[model samples]
Target: MAAEAQSEGGLVFHPLDQFKIYSLFGENPIQWYTPTNVTLWMALAVFCIVGLFVFGTRGRSVIPTRVQSVAELADGFIYKMVEDVAGCEGVKYFPYIFTVFLFILFSNFLGLIPGSFTPTSHIAVTAILGFGVFICVTVLGFVLNGAHFLGLFWMKDAPLVLRPIIAVIELISYFVRPVSHSIRLAGNIMAGHAVIKVFAAFAPMILISGIGIVVTPVSVLAITAIYGLEVLVAFIQAYVFTILTCVYLKDALHPAH
Candidate 1:
C-alpha cells in the first residue's frame, strides 16, 4: 500500500491499484537495494515509533506531558500483556514483541494519510513477519524443551486410537499458523483501504452529475464512518497480533500442557 498510480480511464476507479510497488528513483527494474514505496513507508514507521517512544518521553518528568503519558501507557500496556499471557520468562522478549506492535501500529495509522503507503497491507511484508515469529517460537521450543517440544503435537490425553491421527492434524495446523497470521492482518488492512477508495471515488461525481447531491453526502458519510472504524481496527489488529504472539510464545516455553 504505497505510491500512487494513474489510470488510463478518465478518472482512476481502480481501488486496489494503490497497493502496487514501484521504484522510487526511476523506472528501472527493482533490485535488492532498490528503494520503493514499501521501504520508504516502513522506514517512516520505524522513525515514528522511535520518535514517539524514545525522544517523545526522554524527559520522564514527574508530571508527564501528553506524549510522555502516551508513551508510558503503551509501554505499560504491552508489558502487562506479555507478563500475563506469556508469563515470567517471556518478559525477556518483550522488546521484540513491543517493537513489532509499534511498527504495525505506526504503519496502520500512517497509511490513513492521503498519499502515504502501508507496508502492513502487503502480504510480502506481513508474511515475512509472521514466518519470523513462527520460526522463533518453534526453534525456541526445541531449544528449551529438547525432544519434549514434539509433545506439542502429541495428543497424549486423547483416546488411544485417535492419537496418531490427531498428531498429524496438529502438525499440519502448526505449519499453517504463519499463513493465517499473515493473511488476517494484510487482508484487513487492504480491505479497509479499498473500501475507502471506493467511497472516495463518488466524491468527484458531485461535479459531473446533477444527482450527486444525494450520492455525495451518502458516500461522504459512509467514508467517514468506515474511516473511523478503520482507526479502531488499526489498534485492535495490532493488539491482537501482539497478544497472539505472546500466546504462541507461551506454547513454546511450556509445551507440556
Candidate 2:
C-alpha cells in the first residue's frame, strides 16, 4: 500500500494509516486477548505512570528529585482543582481523578512519538473512560443525593412554565455528556495527529524541482508548528477531561441545583 502511494508521480498521503491497529506479532488474526498496538501503547503509558509515582518517588527525601518534584506538583495541582471545583468534599476522590489525569496525559504525550499509536484517539478507549466517569458519577449522585439528584435536570431558577421544557433539555444534555466527552478527546487528538501526518507525508516527496523546494519547506514548517501545538494540546485535553470529571463529581456530590 505504501509502495503504491509512492509509485505515481503524484504525492499520495494516507494520513490515517497511522491509526490502523495491528498485532504486535505476526498478523494471524486479532482475537479477544490479542496484543495490538493500542494495547502496547496503553500498557507503556501505565508503566510510565508507575515508574514516575512508584520508583521515581520511592525515596521520601527532604530534598526531592526531579521525578519526585513533578509527582508532587501534579498531585498538588489536581488536589487543588478538585477542592476548588467540587469543594472540600471532592478531595476524597482525588486518587481516582488523579489517576484519570495521569493516564490521559501520559497517553497523549506518548502518542506524540514518531511511530506510536494513540489509544485515546480511538473511540473505543475514550468511550470507556468517558462512560466510566458517567456511570460512576451518576451512581454516586443517586447514592448521595437520592431523589435530589434528579433535581439536576430541573432548573428551579427558571420560569414556572419553562421548567418542564428546560428539564427536558437538561435531561438530553446530561445523557449526551459521555458521547461529547469521549468524542471531544478522541476527535481533537486524532485530527491534530492526522494533520501532522499530512504535513510529514509531503515533507520528503521532492516530486518537482520548483515545487519541491516550496512544498517541502512549507510542509516541514507546518509539521513542526503543528507538532508543537499538539504537545500543548495534549496537556490541555488532559486538563479539560480531568476538570470536566471534577465538574461532574461536583454535580454528583451536590445535586441541589
Candidate 3:
C-alpha cells in the first residue's frame, strides 16, 4: 500500500513490498506463502560468506594475498568487536555473532542490486533475528547470573516504596527491545530503497528530454551517491545489531551492573 512518486525527470518510482511475494499450493486452493526471493537472496548471502571464508583460507600462508588479507581483516574486526563489547567471556559466542553480522551485512548489500529483494526489509525476518538474540540473551543471563539476573528489572537502589514502580518500567523496556531492534533495521532499509527507486525512475525521463540534459547528469550523480551511502548504511546497521546484542549479553553476564 505504499505510494509511488514521480521524480523531477518524470520517472515513476513505486515502493513495492517485497514481502508480499508468495506461492500458492495444496488442495482447496490453499495459499502457501513462500518468500522465494527473500529466501533465495538470504541463502545466497550465506553461501557467499561461506564461500569467501573457505576459499580465502584454503591455503594457509604467512604472506597473504588480497583475498586472504581481506578475510583476516574481517575476522580480526569481529573478534575485537566481540571482545570489546562483551569482554573475553564473549569469545564463546563469536561464531553466532559473526554469522548474524555477515548475514545482515550481506542482505543489506544485496538489496541494493537491481531486482533483488532484501530479506531484512521484511519485519518477519528482522523479528526472527531479534527474537533469536532476545532468547539467547535471556537464557545467557539466567545461566550466567542465576536468579540475580531478575535484579536487572528491579532497582535495588530505589526506595523500597518506589521499587515496584521502577520494576514495571524496566520490565516494559526489556520486552520492547525486540520490537525496537527489528523495526530500526527494517525501517531504515525500506526508506532507503524507496528513495532510490524514486530517483532511478526519473533518470530515463530526464535523458529523453533534450532540455533536461542537466537533469541527466544530476540524476546519475545522485544514484551513484545513494549507492555509496547504502553500502555504508549496510555495514553500520550490521555493527549496530551486533553491538546491541553484545550489550544485552553484557547485562546478562553482569546483572548487577
Question: Which residue pairs overlap in candidate 1's backbone?
Answer: none
- How well does candidate 2 score on lDDT at residue 155? 88
| Candidate 2: Cα lDDT at 44 | 99
lDDT of 2 by residue, 1-257 (tens): 66687676466688898999999999879997999998899999999999999998999888999999999999999999999999999999999999899999999999999999999999998999999999999999999999999999888899999999999999999999999999999999999999999888888766645678888989999999999999999999999999999999999999886
Candidate 3, residue 252: Cα displacement in angstroms equals: 1.1
- Model 3 scores a TM of 0.85
lDDT of 1 by residue, 1-257 (tens): 12242322223466887898989998999998999998899889889888888899999899998999999999999999999999999999999999899988999999988767889999998998899999999999999999999999898899989999999999999999999988889999999999999888877667766777998899999999999999999889889889989999999999988
lDDT of 1: 0.89
Ranking by lDDT: 2, 1, 3
Highest TM-score, which number?
2
The lDDT, on a scale of 0 to 1, for candidate 3 is 0.81
Poorest stretch of ten by lDDT in candidate 3: 23-32
Candidate 1 vs candidate 2, TM-score winner: 2
lDDT for each candidate structure: 0.89, 0.93, 0.81
Give the lDDT of residue 75 in candidate 1. Answer: 94
